[model samples]
Target chain A: MPKDSALPSRNGAASPGKEPRTARGRETLRRLLDAAAAEFGERGFHEASISGITRRAGTALGSFYTYFDSKDSIFSALVTHMSQSVAAAAAAAVAPGSTGVRREREALAGFLAFARQHKELYRIIDEAEFADPDAYRAHYMGTAKRIAARFDESVAAGTMSPGDNEVRAWAAMGMNVFLGLRFGVWGEEREPDDVAAEAERLLRDGLGPRG
Target chain B: MPKDSALPSRNGAASPGKEPRTARGRETLRRLLDAAAAEFGERGFHEASISGITRRAGTALGSFYTYFDSKDSIFSALVTHMSQSVAAAAAAAVAPGSTGVRREREALAGFLAFARQHKELYRIIDEAEFADPDAYRAHYMGTAKRIAARFDESVAAGTMSPGDNEVRAWAAMGMNVFLGLRFGVWGEEREPDDVAAEAERLLRDGLGPRG
Candidate 1:
């Protein structure tokens, strides 16, 4: 008997509300994604092959096709997974349920922690995005917009000024970007937490805004 | 027949230390370097091929080898060439001959102009240095030190303040990096010069240590 795919099979008996039935099916999907991430991280998206992924996952070539149509699908899935993880970490950092300055510190610390843990994935995502213009726009601008919304909220309160929240948001995040570019992406030997703390200070006071 | 190459021949005469004996030879070398910049900009160091470079220069592969030993040599040459250009721009931005906020504005504008004009080479050099950790540390660190010195001078004169010139310098340049990333790198639709001006406003005032 053929195994059912958890990805909403092209032909299905269940409605949209129905769920994936088999635990084995879910486990297989997870293994495939994990293996794909490893392979993509090791040998960039272009250089990685289907056989390499299947071999790493210990699954048959035919089995790989059952869940996804192509390698691009795997990449799309990886981006979605990583984006959600980052978003969740960000959400956990700040909330109406918490204090202000403490939440800011938590947010910065949480991001650095995540970056430290997923160095390969971080590199892969950067490489993949810049290698194609369309992907770069979609991924980066989408994140910028989401982050800008929070920056706008800060502006709504007296925390930040109302002069182009987008630019300031980019500026704030840009510090983190260069930090990642140097430390995370380049594999430079420096304390990320230290860099994050320094960046936090820069964001809080700017270059010399309050002196 | 070996014909002629880019570098000066051993048989050629020179006055102490000088360039090519023949004007043609000097132009050939300049053309080769320019071609290498464009080619490397188009395809990053690893992805670009030497044969393609020679073709772009309208010269023979032997001509390339004559000036440089191999692809690695060409890469090194390209890096040195771009480094000098960026350094010159940085120097022009903060000329040894001048001092004050006006000079700072000019310096920033000069650097932004260079980046806008030479987008591809910028990416190539950036990625190249990133791939090689120690490639440009002295250069970047030295530039940072110079800017910090300027900030320190302003503070000592009571034009600025005593709060961490190092942080201020980084934040200033950090604005340039982010503006470049947003306006140029990500293919965002905005005028670079205008964005540079706005960024300058942010650096000089936006985060100006307001009370």
Candidate 2:
């Protein structure tokens, strides 16, 4: 699958209505998204407001209306943006010619780094489960599909045993998400590379088929 | 470790104030928790109300006050209650002489069944991340510790390889959690055993340490 295909849509500006026509408009939309992350991360959905987002973006209130019609729409858009950001970070980390295990490890390491920098990534995406149920489901489903695609490539390359890629993909995604929450968002007690290395081992060689 | 040690505390009634004194009182508290699960599950934290919980529970408003001081306290208690419920379910599913991998598979199966039965589990626990951060952290930490303890047993028994149990435990927990969400909460298209089997395979023998 192409890299951009993994990322969710960017036509988040008011969905059916406003789709940022100019390059400057896209920049403004980007600023609004960054501000939304901060606002939602701090205040959460119920307490979060459009004015709060615009204020953080340093844009006029009119600029906010120019894009999003309401707080819910922008929050939904923000969830998609953050989801894409996660995929983009992982995609950027993995180089060509890496093995399946190596790619999985790199994806995790990139995610950890991203989580550490954007500590709010967990809070925002998690809140989407309640704030925007469809967006939340789409975020996880999209991620699992990407992981499954990687598994397919690995299996095709004869590096990974051909089995149920869907199960493995979900399992891999879960492991990464929790590890990120524990080591990345919770604290930096363990280095990201170290944590990823240990996980890589587990992925490459499980506990045992031995007695 | 003793089984009870695996289970977290249940002093959830009224943190600083009262504890249920009699069997009837405990039953009432349980009823309140079940009702809170339904109310919070359907309406979420912001929309859920005291009266709604009481109404669903079929108990007097005074009964709610008997155990919990406010909506926040009940919600906190509910999160703790759900955490314990999960632990109890997993513990019940694990047989005494099962191998580490077997026990882990059983745990996942148990959790999947629990999630299917209590579809609100994801919502309640996910919501706690925002509503009650401490309880949310406690839930995961307690679960990881339990899994780590199981790892210790497995290593001692010579059934599994010796490695970073903490990392492995978290990875295992994450895999089970996501699998539960996908198979349990999302759909009934897959059977719990088949899902657990695939996960068990991943846990026992990873993608490939060979070719």
Candidate 3:
């Protein structure tokens, strides 16, 4: 979950024998993925081209093939890469020993910040529904599972109520995603802290009128 | 909000001068939209063809032209049509005099059922992000506004706590959307009632431990 770990290698994302071995190679891989994010995020999957990604990365076509076999391969890798980056961002945001709703709030705030910085994240993941179905499903399924685990931990620590953690996790994830889209990606009129505060209040206290 | 009102006419969906006047014309327009839904849902906007929609609709190519100028027009119309259908479904689900969390629960349940029945709903709307950005923004913006209005009503009725209704609306919508995708479209392991029950619990009283 380290910030540096957000960058995926062959083991994490790249296809066979395409992994970057050195720090310089890793930098080049990061550049290509960032460029792919721009290319795919701007032009979408179909209209996006390998040459476009390379041009954006300022790398030669040979450098592109050194990392990815095709546009599809890099796209698939980029999705995975972004997913990891999201996880890293959230992990870095949460304070150690934080539990329950407080933990979720920090995570959400982190996500909003990430979304604002990487406005293309939503577009790429959404496009994956058509361009790469497995990656799309894997991203959500994986994130939901991690969230459910957090719920279990909170419950065991007596910091949170116990219920259907899986359902709650999905619900929580959905809230964060949409909040990111509206407040983070679409517009940044509201501060991340303000948005996360409202969300945290809802997560901690629900909509029922207080006594 | 009536179920029958889900169907869109020229004023509701079609381009200028394309509104169906005759009952049969209305029926043909309905068929074309339904067919467009399937065509776009399965093949996607880029790959979907007017002929494919007509073929699925069992209408002539000329019939397609009668109501729509081209595939783009129909896709835009279909987005509007589906948005209306979702609104109608939610409206029909809430019982008279319902308020607060209970009303939101019913709306989510209604949406879950609708998603189950129309598995293609998510695909078409998600595709609108790329195929039709205006329609996509309008759809979410409009839905969020409606949800916020419901929150205002609930607060006035003293059944729900006062907060940022806009934020709450977007969060509620995100929850319902993901729930639909997971339980309604992706799988049917859980009944709508059961899923809605859990979501209701979360919305009514969040993850905080009981006193």
Candidate 4:
């Protein structure tokens, strides 16, 4: 999986007019976001402090203000950053020419691995529901839209059966999210590939009885 | 669906030694929980206050202390109560002879209806992750266990194909959760049965290309 870009300028993660311009500045922004993830993940939004985030980043308090005006700004940015990171990870995992179930399998596998490494991902995103509802909604809505597009592509390619791609996308996204929660964050007994494979089978054949 | 019992004695929702004995006492306890749900659901854990809960319940402040030790205690009990309510809703929705995908469909449909009526259910339960971690874990773990058991029963009865029931259970639960979030809580544009039928089709046939 590709590393989450430290400079997600294209995604507008940084506050307007405060976007990092130089390599050094981008690195500083990245560190702050990473630190924000840790602070918020550990202490949650209400308890997390700007000082705590800057301390975790090992950057000066002024640097925190350089990129973000306040804790809420950084948190909203962090949610967007994480959402982009998840998308990048899944996209990078899909081999060129892969389609249909195979494409989704690789995506799920990639997400499982990402979730394992970033256990705080779930906590932070889940917290956004209360702290930053818009960002939370954007994350899921954007993800489901991407998944729906994949379904549309696969159907057009004659690789998968067609139905309500929108509903299917939501269902598939839900499946991946919970699988990651159970296998990736909660426990690591199951391999990502293994979990994805079983889930892929379910997606491909479902639970209908076989002859 | 059956009303969430005001006195969930079997589930041990009330703080120890505070379980309401008389019918009137049970009704008050029930009111307190419903009120707690609204308070926590609307204001969230951090912002929610004990006074707010009692005001919503229309009960005296002393009555709140009689059943619950503090706001935390009532929040914990509310999580369990909500979890039980969700279970009761799903169980009551299932027909006696239903099995396999049909049974799961009914369960999802039931939950969607319950969620729509109680939009705050998601907010309260999700907040439990931060406010009451044990209850959070208990809710998902318990729900997944029940779902896995249903899969096991269906497989044993030859109504469905056998696979990893535990993983399948989590996947199905995730699917139901997101669907409920989208259709139940966020919008009422889609009918519960209509959404369930689409999801049921996916569960029954999957995304495989049909001849």
- Chain B TM-score for all candidates, comma-separated: 0.74, 0.92, 0.95, 0.95
Model 1 per-residue lDDT at A195: 62
Q: What's model 1's lDDT at B84? A: 61
State the weakest 10-residue window (summed lDDT) of model 4 chain B. Answer: B1-10
Query: Candidate 4 clashing pairs?
Result: none
Sort order, lDDT high to low: 3, 4, 2, 1
Which residue pairs in model 3 clash with each other?
Answer: none
Compared with the true structure, the alpha-carbon lDDT of candidate 4 equals 0.90
How well does model 1 score by local distance difference test? Answer: 0.60
Q: Indicate which candidate wins on DockQ.
A: 3
User: lDDT by residue for model 4 over B1-211, one digit each (tens)?
Assistant: 1254543543266788987766687789888888888998889888899999999999999998888898899898999989999999999999999999999999999999999999999999999999899999999999999999999999999999999999999999999999999999998988788899989988988898887
Clashing residue pairs in candidate 2 (N, C-alpha, C atoms within 3 angstroms): A206-B206
Error of 3 at A152 (Å): 0.7
- Candidate 4 lDDT over residue span A1-211, tens digit each: 1244443543366787887766688789889999999999999999999999999999999998888989999999999889989999999999999999889999999999899999999999999999899999999999999999999999999988989888899899999999999999999998788899989999998898886
In model 2, where do residues sit more than 4 Å from their true spots?
A1-14, A209-211, B1-15, B209-211
Interface RMSD of each: 4.0, 1.4, 0.6, 0.6
lDDT of 1 by residue, A1-211 (tens): 2355433322132223222346665566667777877888788776888899889999999767766677776666666556556656766756555332334445656666666677665656655543544544566576667667766666565565456667765665555554555555555476666665655555554333233
Model 1, runs deviating above 4 Å: A1-23, A95-106, A183-194, A209-211, B1-26, B43-47, B95-106, B126-174, B185-193, B204-211
Q: State the lDDT of candidate 3 residue by residue for B34-117, as single tens digits.
A: 899899988999999999999999988998888889899999999999998998999899999899999999999999999999
lDDT of 1 by residue, B1-211 (tens): 2245432222122212333446575566667777777877887766778888888899988766656666665665566666667657867666564553445566666776677778875566565544443545544555567778877776666554355555456545655566666766555576655665555455545432345
Clashing pairs in 1: A209-B208, A209-B209, A209-B210, A210-B209, B93-B107
lDDT for model 3 comes to: 0.91
Those runs of model 4 whose alpha carbons end farther than 4 Å from true positions after fitting are A1-11, B1-11
Candidate 2 vs candidate 3, TM-score winner: 3
Indicate which candidate wins on lDDT.
Answer: 3
